[model samples]
Target: MKKVIIPLALCLITAACGGDENDGKTEPEMKISSCYVVSSSSGQSENFSSPVGMYITSEAGQPYEGSGVWSASYNSGAWAMDKPVYVTKAGKVYAYYPYSSNDSPPVLPLDMTRQTDVLYSRVASPIAPGSVSLSVKLYHALSKLVVSVKGEEVTGLSLSSPVKCRFNICTGEFTDLQSGQVTSTDGRLFVVPHVTVGKEMIITLKSGKQYTYSVDGTEFRAGESYTYEFQLNEDRDKLEILDISVEDWINDNNYNDYLRR
Candidate 1:
């Protein structure tokens, strides 16, 4: 009786071990093969060299649990997610720069002092299942301001603009505006896209003297960049606009030229 029981136990263990190998395996993962930022001015696409956060949602506006960050691989130069993102059903995807962990419809608050570029992208159509590769195209979500000073012993600069704004990652729009000050030392600021009428640009000198100029009638649009070249008079109390140029952020080639003395 003991020998028969041992043989029966061994047979049951063998049968369990020989079951389907693929029974509990997860679905195939969807990988992002290529990601690029498109120039709004030139319609040119530049490959992403850094990591960005992404979110996936179903066609019915339900968020996918597998959403996570993606970055370019050092060896293959392809964008890969930190975790497996299964494309088991039809869904949409959204991506943003300066990755954050907030997975719910990814909204970013404008940090004018950081000078960080805000970018966003969304898939227009629902991606079908079994798609092994995806290509994402991102666009600039905020306007860039480049200020260059000439003939001035400047110490610092700041803009009296809307400092509080909620940037919608999906729609690439800015809302809930509030006015405040944003300071800078290098004369670069990433601001919410809006029209300026009564805002002020403050310039500080080595002597601690400050000058003000009205940023009137200037319109800052999404995906656009503006350069304001200023020349200080002999009195050093006034700033005159030397040049103003508007171009797409990614396609602007003359940005550095404005800083050259």
Candidate 2:
């Protein structure tokens, strides 16, 4: 079941929080300032770097059953929940968020697939697609890339809606959350999904190309934010860029609302 583009709903998302009257601290800011592209299991604050960090599991890609610190007693000297959560690979502190699971959390080793979302791509110009900041390091034992799409990434651009909210990082040809196609009216296409946190789309660009880019999402309950980033080819993968753009069959509003499903 594909989802049709809802201009009204999109307007609501893109315009949400712009004129809110609540206490207004603003949504979590969506910006997570880190030092390195890849996080290290053990290192100083300056030496440690990566997008997001948390104690992960070696076998299963999930958060470790790390309690003590999570208990909130760590600052008190003892271990407790709520205290800053740290991982080994980069020893970076992973922000804690309430999820569906609680018992035995799955901490992704080098690859935080459990916290990755959907990835998108399209050909706007002949130039390649990528970001400048590599939040997390591509740990051969972890993942190919660990990007963090903060508020700075998507500034002026409008976020339509929650296209895909997940943390599962996997390789695939993703569907657009807003239009579902690779191309838009003006020829500019949104290759990324409409969701955030828990998801990072990945794809190989033209054999040789590079570009600076950013990403963001609009949230009715929260404000809209963008992430400033850039991407360059790594020595790991040797695949050529899949610079395929989608047709305008999308955003038709009635093309196939069920297709996006």
Candidate 3:
């Protein structure tokens, strides 16, 4: 029988040396202040950066489980969780509510899209110095809707209700934050939907004459987007659905709702 010999150092190399893939590499670190310590019900806070508590998970596309620190601050002798995390790759940082647990990511309620109740996420990479103040911007996680009309005789348009609060935002999951609204003579209305179902919306279109259209059921999905285009035929007797397309809420229009706070 022949005996085979293995090197002890080689057997332990993977465990000791390769365990830390980010070793020696300059990794990005989230600023402790970037995570809001407290938020007001009105979505505005004067001491939003108090650093009272925060739970964060930094992952490269996959979900992670992490615990946050309470009373997190730059003060000496604080919990390790209070410290910033170093990143090996560009990814998302899901920050939980103050003193919240990381058993799961935060959930947006069905009615959370209301301006009075807005939640946000933090996205950034290469977390270098000054990046904390300059590159970091909060974003709302909701969907939006826009409607427009085109016709030779069309003069004005109005809806019985504001187009902003039409859908149920609780059903589907959303990835990005949403805000802003605009209306024009052509019937331009921007809305945010918190649910995935459709609603019966009534609209009045006016040109040389006035016409009413029942947008009986228009569906708005979460994390997804939509735009409705109503075209008036030559007779203008009926409004036709010229197009319904998906839109990227980020690049489309106003997101200054944060400024109001």
Candidate 4:
């Protein structure tokens, strides 16, 4: 299980909310796989879904510097009706903020999703960001998920984890806050959290984008420290399940794939 403590400074002062894009119009994507969420004070974690597009945001809202050497590319497989696209200033896009368009503002593939059937119980972020400096740690987990990011603007093109949970709500859901239902009429598809009358589970992420991703699971367990980052497609969902060590997650080819959709 991963453990974290909301900073005393953040909790005492009027700290702005991170991860969950409560005020923005977009959020990368959040998932709940099979990792455990245990508080440092309690040592408890939860198991949830994992996706590919939310990894960039894991670098935000930390106490140290963050940086990374990874990026999400566009690819196509069984789920895509047409070939997936790699978005750039010169590529065809509609807006560059939400959808991928071959025309219009020519929005790039800024918003993408990848799903998997295998279970990921651990994760590490290479991009960790702070207020002034970013010291990205290689994918590793000695105590918690490590990340490094050092930029004014962070974009969450895609993020994938072995498990997903509200960073603060590692072992449970963030209830009490009223949740507003937002729908994408554009027909883009992604996973969503389950909603209740007074209990709406939401995960705010970096990249200045926040979206809904919910999971219904029971518990989680933790393995030894591990790390890995290889390939990810911004246009598709992803799942990776296997053992890893620092620097091993990226180059190791012995990973087991238990999902094919």
Candidate 5:
């Protein structure tokens, strides 16, 4: 249960509406009594447990005025489907990610190798009876550093610099952020918070071995993903960078099956 304090203006706009004349028409649609909040994400399956918070403001008055905050939890398993979210006013709807109380942009963690789920979307309101769908696009705020060791048992791993990722909560977009050296015990993969293309990565193995990999020339786009395979060169005492590959974030091994559907 995340907590948030919305300004009264947004609250009023979403919760109710004031009586106003319409070109000589008598009654405005008595405030929007109910609505449905549908959620969708590009290249991803449905998240039935994720909730979305929103506010609907009337198009008649100042845009987004007097709207109150409301929450809608998604319960559907079908991708790109609409869920029910009740609203008092029938206007434009503003929706944000995580649906939790925290409206701030998401902070990418140091160890993203295990987790890489972050997405957000917004829908202009006036939510209809059943088809008020809010399409959310999940963006990868972090870049993947895959280090596949073929010869030696890796005892430890750490980056030469820490990667810091910054993104816009409103737009679900990642910015060009920098990273510093951060240590990690996760050897196979490093889910870095920031884009670390063309940077220096220092890897340390359990056998008291260290290798510095110059990130490939490929740039790490926000929504895209990349991989670096490293191996132990038998001819030499040090490690070697095998190869670097890039692909759409949705196509990573974690999403191979779902994206195909």
Candidate 6:
């Protein structure tokens, strides 16, 4: 009777230890199968730059709980996180390029002088557990302005527009607006998406000549590109509007035809 009781006690101890081991085991890490940027106009997909910032929240507008944000770096033609991320429950994922170091929801100030192509993506779905794969697609969040001179060479070009705004990374919204000026020599400027009413484009020639033109009521939208071609008339000392074309930032089929004067 003593031998049987001792053996049973040892068996119970072994079973208890096995149960603790099973409870201590963690869930499998979530995997990101593919991450790429999709062109809003062309529907074409491409890989974004390395090191995109990601944030996972339990719900929309909810703050990230637990460990905080994750960094997804480009590796071997794929985007991967620096460490393992476990999505034990349902949550939403947000990703953006030109990763900001800020832990909170990133709010980027609009700077026309040093413009960059801002890309963002949000996935609002239940990410199941047990080695789940995620596919992310980022889109452009700003408008592109391209100015081309057809007739004469210009020394300087500047735009007097709304240069003040704040871009919210989580919601993909722009707020806090003001008016200012931005100078560009290459005639290419990445600007915040807004209406073009009352905005002015100033061009200075090599002979110290300056011309200012008011842009009409054209609303610049996100992921769109606007091209303005001007022919400098030496005889009249005036700038003639040769053509104005609007296309996607990725340069796809022109949605709007040329507006000629």
lDDT of 1 by residue, 45-81 (tens): 5464566677677777667664333333313656667
Taken over the whole model, the C-alpha lDDT of each candidate is 0.69, 0.25, 0.41, 0.23, 0.47, 0.69
Position 114, candidate 3: lDDT: 33
Residues forming the 10-long window of minimal summed lDDT in candidate 5: 30-39
Better of 4 and 5 by lDDT: 5
Candidate 3: minimum summed lDDT over ten consecutive residues — where? 163-172
For each candidate in turn, the TM-score is 0.81, 0.21, 0.37, 0.17, 0.53, 0.77
Ranking by TM-score: 1, 6, 5, 3, 2, 4
Candidate 4 structure lDDT: 0.23
Clash list (residue pairs), candidate 6 = none
Off by over 4 Å in 6: 1-25, 106-108, 122-126, 151-157, 204-210, 251-261
Error of 3 at 132 (Å): 10
For every model in order, what is the number of clashing pairs? Answer: 0, 75, 8, 63, 21, 0
Per-residue lDDT for 98-179 in model 3, tens only?
Answer: 2233323334332232333233434322333335322222333444445567744344444332333322112224445433
State, as a TM-score between 0 and 1, how close model 4 is to the true structure: 0.17
| TM-score of decoy 3 | 0.37
Q: Give the worst 10-residue stretch by lDDT in candidate 6.
A: 252-261
Ordered list by lDDT, greatest first: 1, 6, 5, 3, 2, 4
Model 6, global lDDT: 0.69
For candidate 4, lDDT tens digit of each residue in 136-200?
A: 11111111111222221222222222223221111222223322332222211122223223231
Superposed Cα deviation of residue 171, candidate 1 (Å) = 1.3
How big is the positional error of residue 261 in model 1, measured in Å on the Cα after superposition?
Answer: 30
- Compared to the true structure, candidate 5 yields what TM-score? 0.53
Candidate 2 structure quality by residue, lDDT tens digits, 1-261: 998787797788767756576644432211223322122334212212111222233223333334411211122322223333222232212332222234222221111212222111111101111221112222211111112222112112222223332232222222323322121222122323233433223322333222222223321111111222333346433222323222111122221121122
How does residue 74 of candidate 1 score in lDDT? 15
